[model samples]
Target: MSEWVDVHFQALETCGKRARTAANMLTVEDVFQDSSAKQPADAAQASMFGDLSHSGALAGKVNDVWTALKEELGTGRSRLQGVEKAIDQVETNLRKATRAATV
Candidate 1:
């Protein structure tokens, strides 16, 4: 997990946020409109409304997943950096060993 990977993951998170916002806005806007006096609000109408509500909730959940994944990605990036540093150190040590052996 390099910085590039972390950045890409963050971009995905941003997309998730935008999607969530859009979903919520659609549902909230519909909520603001009166549901009419019809009982159960017609099966088709109810289903459509329900779908919007469900989508809004799903969007929220997706956002949550992205948030958690972002944190994990940060941890992964740090871990990878540490590994790279360690590898560099080992390479330096190996080079020094080779020079000493040559001498």
Candidate 2:
């Protein structure tokens, strides 16, 4: 049981720290850059596809997908904070259980 508690605490701490780091790293600008990245279609493909100049329907769809993805990534920061809070609660509960066991 003591070992179990130690393991859970360690896992949660690692998870929380990693989550926080990931949340910080995944910023809106990064997402936007990722979304906006473009490669010119090859000559044959461009001729086959037609109208290679404008951002067309497919580009708009890609933007929409990226917009949704970016919003989801934005939530990760709060989710990490929530995980840390839950870990604190679990630690408190474990301490209580330990005290009760000693009694």
Candidate 2 regions exceeding 4 Å error are 1-8, 30-59
Model 1: per-residue Cα lDDT over 58-100, one tens digit each: 6566667655655665565555555555655655565576568
Angstrom error of the Cα, residue 102, model 1: value is: 1.7
**Alpha-carbon deviation at 75 in model 2, angstroms:** 3.3
Q: Which candidate is the best by lDDT?
A: 2
Q: How well does candidate 1 score on lDDT at residue 103?
A: 82
Cα TM-score of candidate 1:
0.40
The sequence of per-residue lDDT tens digits that candidate 2 reaches over residues 49-103 is 3676753655666667666766887788778767777877777787788789978
Candidate 2 global lDDT: 0.67
Residue 35 Cα positional deviation in candidate 1, in Å, after optimal superposition:
38
lDDT measured at residue 67 in model 1 versus the true structure, 0 to 100: 59
Best by TM-score: 2
